[model samples]
Target: MTTDTASPIPSDAEQFGKPLQGWRLRLYTIIFEADTRAGKLFDVVLIAAILLSVAVVMLDSVEALHQRHGRWFDVLEWCFTLLFTIEYIARLVCVRRPWRYARSFFGVIDLLAILPAYLAALVPELHLLMDVRILRLLRIFRVFKLTEYAIEYRLLSRALANSRRKILIFLSFVLMVVLVLGTLMYVVEGPEHGYANIPTSVYWAITTLTTVGFGDITPQTNAGRFIASLMMLLGWGTLAVPTGIVTAEMTSMRRRPVTTRTCHACLTEDQAADANYCRHCGAKLSPYQYDREEEQPVRR
Candidate 1:
């Protein structure tokens, strides 16, 4: 007798190894088929994992975490890196057409997150040159981005995505203005009053623009104070632009219509007979639903 093993290649396996049932036809439409409560919960677990990854990155940068328990922290970092590396490898093994995914953006990220740790071990000095363990902070965003699969979240995401270019352009200009003003202030205000250098002045400008108001550094001269006033005014409107963009997107997302495509198991649409699920989302199609001859509507 042959013992059954989990398929290294994931084929029709429901989300997170949970069985797909109850309109799996529709459930399978998602990259991660998660229509059940358990599946949904598992999805949350993945999100947490991504957040943990970012926490690890931030924690690694802490001097205390490094100084107090260097060995323990090293062990923890290695463990997390190993687990993520193995998971990345597993994804490659299980995903159909792994090469296709490998070439894609997320595939590269999966590789990037773990590659640095391994590189750190293999090469002597190259590790220092390319310790991308810090880049894992980006992974946190990907975890939150999973909300796009949800109809509501996707709508909100679309709004933000649509305005991304414009927002970036606006931010670039803001940064340029900050730099120019910061340099001017650095020259105008002498070194004794915290505007000692161009970089320091720029840092203060950034803090002021973001409305952080970190008073650790302050300007003492008239010219410096004038620049600070302008920065404060710029901060008020500049900071709100991104927030407004995101808020507007969220508002528009709510007004859009919901679409649940034909389920592979449930024949809900009429087509040219060659249709497999709706062209929209791979819902199984039937000719009778739209046909005039089949007029009776029955309870599903």
Candidate 2:
């Protein structure tokens, strides 16, 4: 009798190795997918660390506090820096396309977040560069829970993109107005009245136009004062125009279809209700069903 002696097929874990299927994949999911429980927990922990690091930086800026707890602050800074370094490395390793993650906006932010500590560690003389660590406050963006409002960000981005030309034109007009007012103020006030030069007058005009009165240079003449008053009034009204434009665009955007199924691959949550693929990354939105009973295993 002829015996069929066939070896068993390898599972997905055995076939592709551990990198794509086991704990590595689980780590990727926790790190990258916000919808999952593990992922949410990971984000919570990350946010807490970010907040503590930011608070440490803020406290270090206070001279009294720095004097008393300088050593503790330094230790905490290094700890937070090390934690972020590990996270950054893990993120780079877990993603299938490390280059893509490295080039992304969050990736750049993450690098900036940890750079100061390393810079300080390598070159103690470069302690001045530690001020760049203030940029870590941008981590508040991740903490504000704004990531959950994908639609608002998308709508606002679209509105801003659409309004860019109009906003540019408005800014150009404002600049021309500033130049004319500055020249007039320089001619009227001259050096004695605190208008030292055309540039200084222009600076005063800008400050008045923006309603940011510094009080270091003020128009002593009736004409200059009148112009300042007019500019202040104009500034108040000018601020409303940009707001109205964005509001109109947002209203128009409300008509578009929206969905809550965030793509685990690219974090693109602004898909349509019926979308089967992510609009941003083209990743599968819905899970695929497999009929394991009818499928034949591959012979090894």
Candidate 3:
């Protein structure tokens, strides 16, 4: 008999591999897994609520709208907060390791979605923090389960990670160029021309190099103008170098096929389509099937 030598990746549930059953299993499937009809529906509704809640927060920020419909916005905000509170609690209740999920990236996002509203209630000054509720929109990625997007996100993330050192070195070079240019401009333009000091000149150098050209600072001398032109030309090339590095890394890496099929045991995603075990926890995977008519996963 042939033997598979692949190792299981470590996950939150690696130590406890027992699969969930009964209603907890059903709830987990609905709330965490996005492959089934019910799961998809739950995710769609959750995403809609998230979007609406974020919109309410945004509209509430408008001074005119706040004056006119502040009370209604407050009510709607609480309603969405309560709804999310229930959902967050459900997620905690359903997961085998509640703390694990609670501490996970999305878990913290889920909590943040509800906490700011309550905090705002206790301390009116904190009302501005309600804007953080917009982070809940990040859930759209998990909910939509677009395989192509998932693959691309992984690719981009890996490319960036692999090229971080090179990018860092490039940024250091840019920083040095900015510092040197800023010092030169300060010396050339002096205080009367608004290039008062090294720090202020460095700020100008950054703005000029990025092409932001805020217009608050101006080069009074021909040398200063020439330096600004050099910085602008250098900026264009500097910006493209990082992109090329990441693109090369991405192109060199192999793309692997993945699915939205989630393991009930560990909650690790991006499982292979035909795999019977969780690649992260080695738990037996539940049978995989999706509605053929709804094969295209929802996009954000």
Question: Lowest summed-lDDT stretch of 10 residues in model 1?
Answer: 6-15
Clash list (residue pairs), candidate 1 = 262-283, 277-283, 277-284, 278-283
Off by over 4 Å in 3: 1-25, 100-104, 123-163, 246-254, 259-271, 274-300
- Per-residue CA lDDT of model 3 for 1-300, tens digit only, reads 966222333433342222456777677667755665787788678767877776777777787998999999888978988998999898788766788777866677777677766765666654466554344333233322232123355566667777887888999999999999999999999999998799999999999988889999999899989999999999899879999988877766543344657766665666776688889889987764442234554332
lDDT of 1 by residue, 64-166 (tens): 8767776775676677677666656655555445676567555676666666567666765764665554443343444443463354555555666666766
Better TM-score candidate (1, 2):
2
lDDT of 1 at 203: 89
lDDT for each residue of candidate 2 in 1-300, tens digit (9 for 90 to 100):
965222333322233222445567777667765555677788788877877887887788788998999999889888988898898898787766676667766667677777766765677655465554454344334333333224355457667776776778888988999999999999988999999999999999899888899999998889888988889999998878888877876676565443435577765444665667888888877632321223344232
CA RMSD of each candidate after superposition: 12.8, 14.8, 7.8
Candidate lDDT (C-alpha), each: 0.60, 0.70, 0.72
In candidate 2 the C-alpha lDDT for residue 25 amounts to: 79
The residue ranges of model 2 lying beyond 4 angstroms of the native Cα positions read 1-29, 95-104, 127-162, 263-271, 274-300
Superposition error at 96 for model 2 (Å): 5.3
RMSD of 2: 14.8
